[model samples]
Target: MDGRRPEWRACVLSGAVFAVCMAGTTLPTPLYPLYQDKFGFSELTVTVVYALYAFAVIGVLLLVGNASDAVGRRPVLLCGLGLAALSAVCFLCATGLGWLYAGRLLSGLSAGLFTGAATAYVMELAPEGGASRATFVATAANMGGLGCGPLLSGLLAQYAAWPLYLPFITHIALVAVSAAVLLRLAETVRERQPLRTVRPQRPALPPQVRAVFGPAATASFVGFALFGVFTSVSPAFLTESLHVDDHAVSGLIVALAFFSSTAGQLAVGRVGVRHSLPLGCAGLLAGLALLAGALRWDQMSLLIASALVGGVGQGLAFRGALADVAAASPGHRRAAVISTLFVVAYTGISVPVIGVGLLTGPIGLEGAGLVFIGCMAALVVTAAVYLLRRPEPARV
Candidate 1:
């Protein structure tokens, strides 16, 4: 272990920067309806615009998710920050629907680059003894950063002037400051390769890990799907069904899930990898049930309950699956394997939400949401059953 004081300091700094960049990605969450009103688009168009970001993220992850492991973390992260800035610029210059699409695409690229690279970078800079805390820092930064995005934007957009302009403007300032901090941080990958040497990392599981990867990846998919639906459609539900026009309230309702997700991930340290997965599955089941109640009753309390419960399930399952799969992977192929898992997880974020969008045209938003919850619930249950039948080894 290098065990240098500079290393720990840099680790925490990088995590803060990671959070800031991630916050930019979701800042538009609560503002989407405003964009829709301005751009004059359909609900389906909104989902399409939102899903575009996930597709872009998945594309970057598959194309070069492990690039930081080769070309050094700093360079790749800097690239991500650049994309983030470009996204902010896109949003700031929004004149029509195309700008929104461009912004989301760029944001996706930024997030895809940041997700694996920033995560590994933070962990690498920590003191060897501080692995557990460092892991929490990295994961919490990811989910928490995501949680803050909408809340910040919603408040500014709702009460502050220039809703469209202010959010991106504020994010631009954050990106600039974060870029300065990031530049001062140390590069963790000492023996770096050229960018050209990095190529697409397809999901290749090791034989031993292959057993655990399925249930784990499935949990990740289901969790992310729940989040996707929430991020894309739940706001519309809040406004239409609950008669909530308050952007702050809408943002807070959405933020609840991501915040709960961070709390759920933190629980993994105490719960252990073996138990977190099943517990996550349980949380997911309960969450889905709550969401069904929300749909049936149209109660604001039920909706909030669903978000909190579902977020916890997502966090527990994702963290547990990630730790187990990472442990089971051979050192040489570890990055690619984890990237593969993320590819699956990110796919969940896009496809299912789009499915809901399509269904919304045929049925109403609530009806489509009911169908979505039912489908996702069945998948989560299948995954839970499989995990029960083939429990992960305690150490893994």
Candidate 2:
């Protein structure tokens, strides 16, 4: 085990690298309004652009989710960073809507590769008896890095000159540093195969895992859907409805939701697996209600509260869903099973956000938002009820 300390260090370093790569995905969150102004596009177009990223992520997850396992983590991560660099370049040179769509799609590819590989890599790097703590580190890096992206870009864009170009330029530098850091980390795969060995991954359910998958997936779906709406449209809402136009303020608000989610995920260990799902569902339901109230009242305070409370609920439910599904999955198929759950979670992020975007033309932002809140609330309530009826799974 003496040799494992170095692996642990390598794992932590890799997780940090993963965080930096993922951060690039949201670097444009606070700047969406700026893009809208430059391109003269509607809010619906903004959401469509955002949904494109989710679509790319899902596509990669379905087609090559296990590429890292087969070909080696380092290569996959390096490729992801390369794609991320290209994405930054696209944004830096963006001239039209197509550029934004291409950039988002590239960002999605980077995230898709990192998500599963980085999580497993971190756990593998941990010392004996350190799995649980390592899980937090990996997850925190994932969500926390996502939170930091907009915060960093927004602040830079607001204070520094070249609001559009500077953010991607900064991301390029960070990605370079992250790539260098990743090169020094040890490869977790023992007998890595050739790239040709990679194949499309199919999502399937084993009977044993089906019982927990339902409620856990439900909560995860609603939770991610909440996040989807917040990240995709909240900045627009802040500018249009609340008359708060500061880019930094908008980024900070969105960051708060993701950061709060990290905090909420941390609570799951104490909450226990059984209670985490139901309790998280409760938080999601409350968050949806708060969001609906915000839309109805047109209050900035309500938006902030919805972000904080709803984000916490999302974090709780998301982590719980992952844990529940992972525990129930057979060892051999664990990665595949987990990928399926993520597909479900990410589906939540895409479909509903697009629905809102589609509805924006007919009903307006407030009306569309209210409709989203109602649907998500119903889903969360359903999940909570299911949790209540079924016996809680045995905790690890």
Candidate 3:
């Protein structure tokens, strides 16, 4: 019992560190408006800046996503923390747009490193037969941390001094404390390897995984795309159309989607993975409809509803997809297959938001948002149909 207690403690401690790193990634969500005002840039610039982080994350996932498996987890995670600190520093010293770009890029790298590695570490830290509960811990830390980012920054930006500087500064301190905690935890990987032996992981799927991967990947894509739109553009919508200027409210609205996603993920345990995907699609479709109504009528209530419902859908679909895909892949190539799914997910986050940014100038934010919703709705409906028609096999 004493031995098991320490393992659980380490598991929880690792999850806390995971949360801290992820919180840094979304820390700037509510601050984008302030950045636009300060830098005299257009809305397109904000979307581009946000997309840059996704792009960087994709790059790292492709390039070195499996580094921790080769080198020790502690080394890779420490490097991620270093990148996060640099990102914070860049934000603190922002003289121009360049600083924001650099900061976001570094933040993306930090997230990329943490996403796969930290998750594996947390799971490994759990006592034997604790895989199921550990999975929830890793996922909650991820979505919960992302949710906390904007909430924390929004409150600090609104109520506290240094709207710009204080949030990142606080994050830096958290990063430091997290690093110390990480150092104290024993390394989980039994066989250590040099960084030079690590190779960039290419996205690959075994022949058997292709069938399930399609619907799974599609659901994952639409789910992340919805988040991309929410995190990148919802605040602008609130400020421009609703004329709601409070940073805390804006942060809470955006954070709602992520927090709701966490809730959706928790439901997967009860809903069963097979049923979760199609049900999640229904939720996403409803959420998109709500967003459309919000956009058309400029109703704040509808917008909030959209965030909550869509977030839950994203959570359910993503977690279900992940669970299904992981079960199907061969153990030898699991990491590579999972990385490919993430590549698709992050692409969803990047491409659609950039498209919205491009269309914003010609059609206005509302029109662009409507267009995005329509496209995503069609995609989610298709995925739902596929899932319903050919339910994912218990094992593909």
Candidate 4:
């Protein structure tokens, strides 16, 4: 116990660093409209730009998801932060759509490197016998950081001098501070190898893990799909349908969903892993209903309710899915399996968002959003029913 304090402190600091880095990925969420006006691009182009980040994340996960285990956590994390800084620099110097794409790609790469590595790193830094609490820290940092990005950028852009440049500049400063903090932390890997030895592993499932993977992955897909639409297109919905054009307001609305998700994740410990999947699906279904109402009636209140309620459902489902999958996976293949799950979740984020964008031109934003809500509602209901039919195997 005497020697554990420093490591625990390191865990907290690392979580903070994780939050800052993740925040960079969504800094432009509120500013998408500004970019559209500046560059004169269509809504489809915006979704495409957002999908570029998800694509880069999936690519990195497939190629090097477990690189930190081979090399070391700190190095990969530092590399991620460096990429994050470079991304901010790109945004700061953005003169065209290409720069935005480049910045988003770099941001995605940063998130990809950090997602698995940082979560594991935080857990390792915790005092022994604190795995559950550490897991909460890791997850909260992940979701909380995502929540903060838009809020920070929105506030700065609303009140600060340089709406576009200030947010990235602030992130650059934060990254510099986080890098320094990271330099002081000790490496967790004992027999770390060189990065050159790292190779991509195929994201395949073993026959035995399929039963546990199925429901968890389904809930995750539905949850992430909801988040995908909210983050990618909610601003347009607010602007075009509701006549709410304030960037700060849009950012706050998006941030609410993520914040609510953090709350939902915290509830998982009390809810227990066994119940989380079905409960999450229930919440997601309700959320979809709220979103549908928002689209149908064009009510801002319904949109806000959807963000809060749906976000909680997503949070519950995603974290529960992660815990279920991780517990069932063999130690040797845990990281790979988790990476596969993330790929599925991210696919939810990217594909549905792009679908909404594509449909916006034909059906308009509200109609496209309603269609998305219907599809996600169906997915969530199916997942819930599946979970009900096949109860999770009882834990000892």
Candidate 5:
């Protein structure tokens, strides 16, 4: 217990750093609507702005996703933190629409660096035989931090001075603290190579990981797509249709999906990885159904229900999918493999979201949302059927 204590502390601290970086990625979520009003941009423009972040993330993941594995995790993470701070600074200095685009693009680079590297760092910091607990720590930090982003910004934007400025300022401070924390943590990669040796990794699965990759990637894509739509447009939906203009309320509603996702990740431990994927798909189906009802009836209750239910579903599938893929991967290539999964996931977030945005002009937000839901439901259902037919190994 004595020796394990320090390891556990390091593990938790690493997760904290992970959380801070992810929080920065979503900090602008609740504020997108405000930007829309301030800049007088169309809903399509808002979606495009949001999708830009994911695109940058995808670009980074493809280009240099495994840099940590070669040069060591610390350097990559520090770069990520640096990028995060710069992203925040961009937001604080926003004088026009161009600034928002630059900020989000930089934010995406920060998240892209952190996602694979940090998750691997947190898990590696765990003491021997603590993989399961460490998995929880990493996943909770990711989802919890994401949930907190909107919640933090919403409250500040609604009640505090400088709704736009204060949130980014606060984020900048948090990034500083996170960087300090990261510097103190020991690097987990023992066999380090030069940065020049860290070439871009094409997204391909090793033979061992191929089977698990398919179902895992499918579920991850669906879950992230669900999140993409919710985070990108839910605020507008609340304001325009439900007549809910409260920033705090919009933020809370968005946060619920992420918070519930954390709750769902917890359930994976009890449910077992074997069952969790299919079950998560089922939850997604229900969540999609609820979202349809909410959009069709324009009911606030149904909207909230969709967030909670769908979030849980996302949590279940994502954790299960990640665990399986990680277990199957060779340690040398783990981060790259993880980044590949994220690429697919972020693709889900970007492509479908832009599609929704494109539809919004002709059909309206409700119509666009329903169309998005229908497409996601079909994808999740396909993933569910596949999972049930060929359940991945229940390693965890």
Candidate 6:
């Protein structure tokens, strides 16, 4: 969205709307075990159901990823919000595994639409001189919203009446309010094109960008993979192995990672871009080791430590990698390259998560998680070494 001036209030409201939609994507994080019981499915099935959302998100990214740029942000965002509401309804009325699968896919579609468009919309709505602060608002909204999902739902499920039903119902109300707020906002695209003209353009990376992309993308991939494991299987681990069955606690543990990630990202300004990547890798390594300890000892404290450390690592490396990659990309190909990077990072969430699922049946959850940590640790170590050997120049 890029157009005539609107109150900066509109920008913040748009960020809030973005937050609401993103929240729906992860609302079920703490409730997955419940779904498993209801459907009489194994942990492997639960992971598969969760991975379906990521796969759907990837599909949407490949197909209609840029549709908002042509058709206008409001149209796309509204549609996204609508899909989010439908996803919630699917959950509210879930009768079996099919409903769960459908809900996840729809949620993924909503997220794929909102990810780029909402960020751009939030930026476009910013008033003069408010760009930096507005960027923070948008960034925090994305991560903060993800953090809030489990916290809100977990509390409601644990303490309130009707565990599964209330969360989606509350979210549906929020989506309604968001749609109203969205309608009042000004249209950002001044010269919007027809949706028909928006095609799936293949992502291209110039040679120079490829050099930067490899290690930078690795940081993002590993970070996202860590999160994927936490969101999909950690609750099961907590309940079954760690002997912690409280929904609120589970939600908070999951939420901590996303919240810590925000802190990690904010730290980048002080840590310096060059330091952030390697430092991030170090944090990730620490987090991984902590996770291994958590699994081996079945210690709640160790698990919490892993979340906080891993989150910081993810935020630091991912943000720094993005900055360096953007700096290296030719101006004309910058957006495409960034999009390509995101696709790879998101794949880390899906592919590794499903792999854990497959391994859960044979090796067990803790063993599968250890395998995941070992693999991601290797990737993060490689990235760290590369960054140390050849630091990204301060200029570019």
**Best candidate according to lDDT:** 5
lDDT scores of the candidates, listed in order? 0.87, 0.84, 0.89, 0.87, 0.92, 0.85
The superposed Cα distance between candidate 5 and the true structure at residue 212, in angstroms, equals 0.2
TM-score for each of the candidates = 0.96, 0.95, 0.96, 0.96, 0.98, 0.92
Question: How would you encode candidate 5's per-residue C-alpha lDDT over 25-79 as one tens digit per residue?
Answer: 8888889888988889998998999999999999999999999999999999999
Candidate 6 collision pairs: 2-188
Off by over 4 Å in 4: 1-5, 206-208, 394-396
Please state the error at residue 247 of candidate 2 in Å: 0.4
lDDT at residue 251 of model 4 (Cα atoms): 91
lDDT for predicted candidate 6 compared with the true structure? 0.85
Candidate 2 residue-wise lDDT, 1-396, digit = tens: 788778678778877897898899999999999999899999889888998988888888899887877887788889999999999999998999999999999999888887777777776777877766677777778888889999998898889999999989998999999999988877778887899988898877778888888888888889889988988998988888788888898889889888988888899889876787788888788788888887788888888888888878877887777777766877545556776777888899899999999999999988899888888888888888888789767532
Error of 3 at 300 (Å): 0.6
Candidate 6, residue 143: lDDT: 77
How well does candidate 4 match the true structure in TM-score terms? 0.96
Per-residue lDDT of 1-396 in model 1, one digit per residue for the tens? 544777778888999999999998889999988988998899999899999999998999899988988888888999999999999999999999999999999999999999888877787788877766677788788888989999999999999999999989999899999999988888777788887899886667668788788899999999988888888888898888888989898888888999999999999999987888989999998998998899888999999999999999989998888778767766555556777887899899999999999999999888898999899999999998888788545333
lDDT sort, best first: 5, 3, 1, 4, 6, 2
User: Where does the lowest 10-residue lDDT sum fall in candidate 5?
Assistant: 387-396
What TM-score quantifies how close candidate 6 is to the native fold?
0.92
Score candidate 5 by TM-score against the native: 0.98
Q: RMSD (Cα, Å) of candidate 1?
A: 1.9
Model 4 Cα lDDT, one tens digit per residue, 155-240: 98888899999999999999999999999998888888988989997788766677788888889888888887888898888888
Runs in model 3 deviating more than 4 A are 1-3, 330-332, 391-396
- What's the residue-level lDDT of 80 in candidate 3? 94
| Residue-wise C-alpha lDDT for candidate 6, range 1-396, written one tens digit per residue | 254245577888999999999899889999988887888999988888888988887777777776776788899999999999999999999999999999999998998888767766786688876655565566668777888999899999999999999999999999999999999988887778888888786656777877777887889899889989999999999989977779999999999998988788888878977898899999999999999999988999999999999999988887777767766766444434556776777798899999999999999988999999899999999989998898555333
Clashing pairs in 3: none
